[model samples]
Target chain A: MLEVKNLKKSFGDRVILDGVNLTVNDDEILCIVGPSGAGKTTLLRCITGLETPDSGTFLMNGQPFDPQGTKDSDRVIGVVFQDFNLFPNLSVMDNITLAPMMVLKETKKDAEKQAAQLLSELGLSTKGDLYPWQLSGGQKQRVAIARALAMKPKILCYDEPTSALDPNLRQEVAKIILNLKKSGMTQLVVTHDLDFAQEIADNLLKVKPID
Target chain B: MSLNYVFEILPSLFQGAWLTLQIFFWTLVVSIPLGIVVSLGLTSKIRPLQWILEVYVWLMRGTPLLLQLIFVFYGLPIIGIVFQRYDAALVAFILNYAAYFAEIFRGGFQSVSVGQFEAARVLRLSYWQTIRKIIIPQVVKIVIPSIGNEVINLVKDSSLVYVIGLGDLLRAGNVATSRDVTLVPLLLVALIYLILVGICTLVLRRVEKRYSYFK
Candidate 1:
């Protein structure tokens, strides 16, 4: 289980996340839904260590979690950015294998083997040698998910996973999220698509901007 | 225009070209890395260091390379910072080119988006790993044409060493021309410079091709 207590964040004088709290059970999907300017993405960013909360505490399995300690939090949390932030200079195979080899000290063969597995699982088996620019929107998103999964994070976060997809692709993403849940992956998704959230979220947290 | 005259001046011109090549090679060896470091400092968060480097770049870029060489060779002696003619030309050339390269690298660094850094952070990549694997490849792609421009300029700018009485290629040509009362040596010198720059262009094109794997 992961718990966030009394999270608060402000940029200059504008408060984004004000004293927010949430919880996610193991092997569950948690969706954060809010309109524009409601700080749903900000909350996810704070949880993923992309932004520092003014004051907050994160607990993983009842132990305190420190997102600022990169080494400790890196393996514990992963993010699939809105734009899919794949390394443009790298092919899909290399993008997925880079962190495993560089940070996890896995051999190139081992990392490539695991990346091939993930690509096959994500229906990207033949796309490994292709660059991100060549992939369609849905394919890129799946590659981003595969890239994050390669790290084997305890929890994965997504920022607007369905924002760029069409209706059919949105359903495709929902199915992928459901499949991840079946494999016992914890997830936090922030999006304004309430219907999509309701379709995949085991629980939903709604946020409103603090004036 | 005679082959005999060309051969007669060839040895002396070759000697001067050797010195010119030495200055060019050493200046690039030292200045390229120095420029990368200075560019990192420019983008760093330290305010005073950024200001200092900004002023340094401004000073170096604002002045002519010839004037800088003259200042290092002739003007610094009054302040007790005397250097040999060859050393003075090298010091001035390195400092001046480093400034231009710094600006070029700074632009390359800025072109990278903030998300690239954030992605590296979440992936547990150390600072150096991020720079080596992710950042550098992208920056190199973006900055190669700019770097090629500077490199070609450095080849031509090496002639500025002649102002310090160093017998560089242009100076040797000038000597032969004045002594023989003929323009042939100067023409040969121009041909030599064209050949050097042509080689650089071919090599740079190959480098650019290697990085063409991505857009």
Candidate 2:
């Protein structure tokens, strides 16, 4: 479980996230639904250590969580960016295996084994040799997920996972999120689509822009 | 214009060409990596270091290469920092080319998107690992054409060693031209430069092709 309390963030004079509070339970899907510029992404970024919050406390299973720390936080919190920022220079296999081999000090054989497993699980078993630019949008999305999951983070966060997809792809993403939840993976998805949120969210949090 | 005269000066011109090649080869070997380090320094967070690099780049780029060569070979001895003629020319060439390459690499570094860095950060890749694995390959792809241009320039600029009385290709040609009172050696010198530049272009194109596997 992850808990965010009294989170606040501002850029220059404009406030984005103001005293926001939320909690995500283990093996649960928490979808943040809001219009554009509602700080939905900001909240996810703050939680994942991409953006710093002005004031907040993050607790993982009741222990203080520091996402920015160099310890286990990196392995504990994984994020999939909105655009699926896979390393363009690397093949899907390398993209999934890079962090595991480089940061976790896993042997290349072990990393490749785990990446192959993740790729198969994500329905990209045949696409591992291809580069990110060669893959379709949905395929790239799956690769990004595989890359994130290879790290074995305790909680996975998505920034507008379906924003760039078609309706069919959106349904596919919803199915994937539901499937991940079934496997006991905690997920926090930020999106503007209320219908999609309603389709998969075990709990929904609506954010409004701070005027 | 006669083939006989051309043959007569071929030996000396070849000797000069050898020196030119040496200067060009060593300058590239030393300066390319030095340029990368300087470019990283230019982008680094240390304010004073950045300022120093910026000023260094400005001084090197803003002035003439010819002037720098003269300063290193002639003027510096007045301040008791003296070097041999050949060494002084090399010092000037390396410093000048490094500055230009540094700017080119700095541009390459900036062209990479912020998302790449963020992704690497989230993956827990160390700073050096991130630079080596993620950032450098992309930057190398982006900067190849620009770096190729500088390399071609370096070939021609290596002739400037003639100013310090070094027996580089152009100096050899000049000496023969003045002694024999004919322009044949100068024309031969130009042809040699074209061949060198052509070879560089081919190698650079092959390198660019190798990197094209992704984008």
Candidate 3:
């Protein structure tokens, strides 16, 4: 379970996320929706330790989560950016296996074995040798998910995942997230695409702007 | 002017080129990795360390190589730091080129996106792993052309070591010209530089092609 109590963040004199509180259970999809610049992404960043919050206590499985030091929480939480942010220089297989081999101390053969399985599940089996630049937006998004999944995180977080997709591809991303959820992966999606959000979210959190 | 005269100068020219090659080879062998270390210092989180590296880079860029060569060869002995002619020239060239290469590397490091670091952090990669696997390979691709330009410049700049009486290729040409009263040695030196730079351009182009997979 993940819980945030009175999470507050400010940039200079501008307040982004103002005294927000929320709780998320295991294997649940929680969607955060709000107007642009209302700090929805900031909240997600704060949770992932990408951005430091001014004040808040975050807990995952009853342990305090520290944003500055991801030592204990990196494996517990993963993020997929809207842009995908895949390593352009590496082949798909290399990208997916990197974290496992480096962080988990798995042998290359073992990591690749797991990666091959994950790629097949994500329908990227045949595309493993290709670089990220060669993939379509939808394909890149799927690879990003596979890359995150390779870490075996308890919760996967996404930032405006569908914002860059064509309207035709939005449904595909929604289905992918739903599939992960069905497979017992907890998720927190920050997106403006509410219809896509509604299709996957078991619960919703609204982030309101402060004057 | 005669083919026979050019042939007579060949041995001397080759000897000079050989010495020039030595300076070039030694400087490149040491400076590339040293530049990376200095670049890391420049980007380190410690403000004082960063400032120190910044000032070092600044001083190196601010002073002329000629003055540096002269100082290392001549002035250092006053401080009980005597050096051989060859070693003094090598030290000066490596320090100067290392500074240049460090600046070029800094540009390469900064060219990488912030997203790369964030992704690495989220993936639980150690800081060294992130740099070794993720950042450096990408930076190499981005800065190949910039580094290539500096290397070609190094070939031309290697001639400056003659100022310290190191007897490099240009110095050999000077001796041949003064002794033989022929312009052939100078023209030969020009051709050798062209060949060296041509070979480098080809290698650098192949590197750029290999990295084309990314962009």
Candidate 4:
């Protein structure tokens, strides 16, 4: 569902992602592993249009994803970063419904309805009224996933979702990812979890840091 | 010092306080929206916009309010843009306060994460919608304290109207002090200022509590 080609990115004199190419298929789970500073996150960010590529072509369902020229892409894609970029000012329901209300123009009632349903499924039903700071790391990750799913995107990109959590909490977050994978959501995850990379991913691409 | 003179002038002082209240309320009503627009312009992505906003902010902030008051009340007639002294002072105060509030508002807008902006963009929210629904709420919470500070400042600054002979609270107090030759009326005027500041502090403390997540 997503195609990335010859992606090149440089910060100042150092090249982070040099001539990287990857493809993500529909309903597929791909795990990308790399050493620190390997540009795995940068590459994922480029695909999600969080950062502009120095030179690359991104295609979603054969439609062009040109960051410089296009205001938006044709496909719906959601991202969950390692830092859990929830709006600290908004409640869980507000965070989850943000994109739908703003991007999709969903009414507040409809957005709240969907947010309630999704939060319930993620085991965050009671926490919907709470803000991000009130939640634990694992719960925040679940809210992040619910936020992405609330977009109803064709592809979900995760940038090391569970890396910040402790081992026990990591497994809890892993369960959420496993559920997404089972639900047939096309997901691209940049991760260091070898077990998840080996067991759950339909494809695993190991990336090494550039010299 | 006869105390009856102070009580005799109380009715006029109250009337002047009422005028001060009007000016304060109207200026805030006018200046806040003006500040938001100025802030949006200041943060515009385009270079020309950035330049224009930069110059506007610099000009408004660099000049003294007293000078700005004189310029509005007395200087504009050189180009035939004449106004009544009261209108001139009102315009000057609104414009001056708008600039400072704009900068404060820009800080508030900056506090929202880039992630939120990107999420709004990806969701296909129009730029206006993103600002009205997403950006404004965040900005409101962020800007409340500073805005409250400015609101209190504006209450005192309204006394600057005396420079233009608009007979605001300070001018009325000045007139009363000269006639009564006592310090109580002046102290009473200071008390009024204190009361204004105290009310603003209470309201803003409540606002800060409502948005304490920002802290």
Per residue, candidate 4 scores C-alpha lDDT tens digits across A20-124 of 988888888888987778888888878776678899887888886654333545546778868777777778888888778766778999999999998898888
Model 4: docking quality category: acceptable
Q: Residues B80-187, candidate 4, lDDT per residue (tens digit)?
A: 999898789889989998999999999988888887787655455568877887788788988887898899989999998888888788878888889867777788
Give the lowest summed-lDDT range of ten residues in model 3 chain B.
B163-172
Model 3 / residue A125 / CA error / Å:
1.3
Listed per candidate, the RMSD to the true structure in angstroms reads: 1.3, 1.4, 1.7, 2.6
- CA lDDT, every prediction? 0.92, 0.92, 0.88, 0.83
Of 2 and 4, the candidate ahead on TM-score is: 2
Q: What is the lDDT for A71 in model 1?
A: 59
- RMSD, candidate 4, Å: 2.6
Give the clashing pairs for model 1: none
Interface RMSD of 3: 1.2
What TM-score did chain B of candidate 1 earn? 0.98
> What DockQ, between 0 and 1, does each candidate earn?
0.77, 0.82, 0.76, 0.41
lDDT of 1 by residue, A97-167 (tens): 99999889999999999999999988999999999889998999999999999999899999999988776
Could you give candidate 1's per-residue lDDT for residues B23-131 as a string of tens digits?
9999999998899899989999999999999999999999998999999999999899999999999999999999998999899989998888888888888888988
Q: Estimate each model's TM-score.
A: 0.97, 0.97, 0.96, 0.91
TM-score of chain B of each: 0.98, 0.97, 0.97, 0.94
The prediction achieving the highest lDDT against the true structure is 2
Better of 2 and 4 by lDDT: 2
User: Which segments of model 1 are wrong by more than 4 Å?
Assistant: none
* DockQ category of candidate 1: medium
Looking at model 1 chain B, report the run of 10 residues with the lowest lDDT sum: B119-128
Per-model clash counts, in order, read 0, 0, 0, 1
